[model samples]
Target: MIEEARIKKNLKQFTFPRLSGTDYEIKAYKKLTKEVENLNLKYKVQFFTFSSFYSRIYPKIGFSSVSIILFLFYLNIHMSISIILILILFTILIISIILTRKPEKIQFITKMDSQNVLVKIKSLSKEKKNYDRIALFISHLDSKGQRFTIKIRIRIFKLWITSSISLTATIISKNSILRGFELIFYIIGLFPLIFNLLSTIMMLLNTTDNSSDGAVDNASGIACNLELLNHYSIPENRLIIIYGFFLLELKNAEQWVLDIFIII
Candidate 1:
């Protein structure tokens, strides 16, 4: 049977200023460790850093958009080889930036150290398969604060529509310099630029207003994971069950035990 009381205790203990890399997240990690230890369960803790405050792709698109915007500011309505060269440069920039966007590019300003709590229970049942297997019960201990919701999704769809039109217009327009390549560059880069720019604005707002209590979003998942650990045991011979508590999941930073899970 699942223990609802542990869920409440976790929710109560999770009530803190958990902004990814801040002291709040650290405290939460500590609390998680304590909980597992109280169960007399052996676990491992792995720490990692990620770009929580500022995303790398946001600024890349922003710079590309601003550059195209400025180039169009003084552009003339004429076709020229220079316009083609500009397109090539912009394409190269965008592609290279996207390719190089690894975890290391995370901004140094707010690069945060987050923890993953991992618990493994060997299966008790006999294995029928020829190969060893593992199963993961994944959950996140942190919550996210979002200031923008469906409005942003609607806007993104609108931007994509306009951007498609803009790209098509570039192909048919007579003046390749003024309207074709120039507008296409602006539209392509501006998509992410505008979206992330608005996201940044909402993030700024969320920074001041702490209205997000993400109990149902992910605290419930963690609570269920803990309950499984507390009340039940997996069939060891069938599979090795691994429970992982991920941080910065909302930030697209779940790279840690994933490789191990995939390899085995």
Candidate 2:
């Protein structure tokens, strides 16, 4: 049955990391559209833009800051011990703020062709008065795979623990010296967040295929969608299934979704 086919197609669509603008994503969209059309369902193929998951800005910033800090530390100025301590304390505070300001990952979006994409989709159902709105099936189509070496993983974990401890110290320590140290720790903690953001940006710009077929990352998700369509009989209500391929390097999901709808 057509319903069965839709379910199968959904499965395929979700079987890979559907990074925005990737070949796999494009192909999957095309296949989904064709299947929907075959079922005599009126559908639209919307496009959107999102931040790339492999940006390099954050990492670059972290490394650059570290280098600068090291260079400054090496230039042993003739300051009194008290002055040196004060400087270190200030530096720690700055570092903490920087870390806290690091942007979030998974902040990409699809561009829709219209400012009122949601409205348009809603209209489709509204025009067919017989069709009631049933459920909104939302799923993201993307894949994330990190080829972290053992050394890198260990280093990352260590840094993460250190960052957490430093943050806790900052919160709990009342002594001015401890507070200063906490500030520095906070800044250092930000390095990882920045690095991640930069990597995400890079991913958006590159054609690198980091995933191995993205089977579990997303193919499984698509498969699940298809299965749902197949198993569930057509309801009197309209089904709104959203296949989203977002850039995972950004920080705002709601904003990204709004942007996608605007493009649609």
Candidate 3:
């Protein structure tokens, strides 16, 4: 039985801020293991490390690239030279993005250790070998905090994207109507550059921390997964269930787990 009281209790137990690589996160992982132990289920812990450099640097790269391309449009240089510069900038951006995705291939940042908890529940049926399917439930175990709220960040990002598109359209379009209105469009484009530049500066200023209670963001999710674990543990259930309490901030960790599952 998945009791609401038990679920709420679990939620309350996990509501505290527990940022990855921190002592509080270790405490939360301990509590999670204890809960699974109470159910008498065997589980495994998989540990891994990741760097935050890519997450922090990618947005700045995108913003700077856009700003520079827009600035190029106003320069009095030869058209061929301007095109060559833009192509070079784009090539650099593409390479940076590819390199950052595989951060281990480059060695410029600090790596932080984290772990994921995995539990496998066997099927009750004697014909389990015939059933090759497994059910997987996943919930992340880390909480993040930043200076700006998610809503504010989303709005700023939307505005930046929309303005960038508009500016690019104005710069490239050759329609007579648009050409007649080019002066107005250029003037309008300046505001977004200024505004988005400030937004980018604000984004750079914001730092990750551990201050939020994380009740809604992930405590509730963890609670629900616990309840599901309780429900699916019954001998009457026929399908195997795998519960994964992952550290999603580290994408490679999740991929490694999936690879293991595939090999199984």
Give the number of the best model, judged by lDDT.
3
Per-residue lDDT of candidate 2, residues 73-105 (tens digit): 323245575466556656765664565464343
Highest-scoring model, TM-score? 3
Q: Can you list the residue pairs that collide in candidate 3?
A: none
Cα lDDT computed for each candidate against the true fold: 0.59, 0.43, 0.75
Inter-residue clash pairs, candidate 1: 122-236, 123-235, 123-236, 123-237, 124-235, 124-236, 125-236
Give me the runs in candidate 3 sitting further than 4 Å from their true place. Answer: 75-88, 100-107, 128-130, 173-185, 253-264
Backbone clashes counted, model 2: 50
Cα RMSD of predicted structure 3: 3.7
- Give the least accurate 10-residue stretch of model 3, judged by summed lDDT: 255-264
lDDT of 1 by residue, 99-119 (tens): 446644555555667777888
Please give the lDDT score at residue 41 for candidate 1.
Answer: 74
Per-residue lDDT for 1-264 in model 3, tens only? Answer: 769999889999999999887888999999999999998889999877766666666667777787678767743268899899899889879988888777744445656778899888888776845346666777888888877898988877787777667666656652344677666766766776666566666667767788877898799988999898888877675367788888754355445345233222
Regions more than 4 Å wrong, model 1: 15-17, 52-101, 104-109, 126-131, 153-157, 160-171, 174-211, 233-239, 250-264
Better candidate number, 1 or 3, judged by lDDT: 3
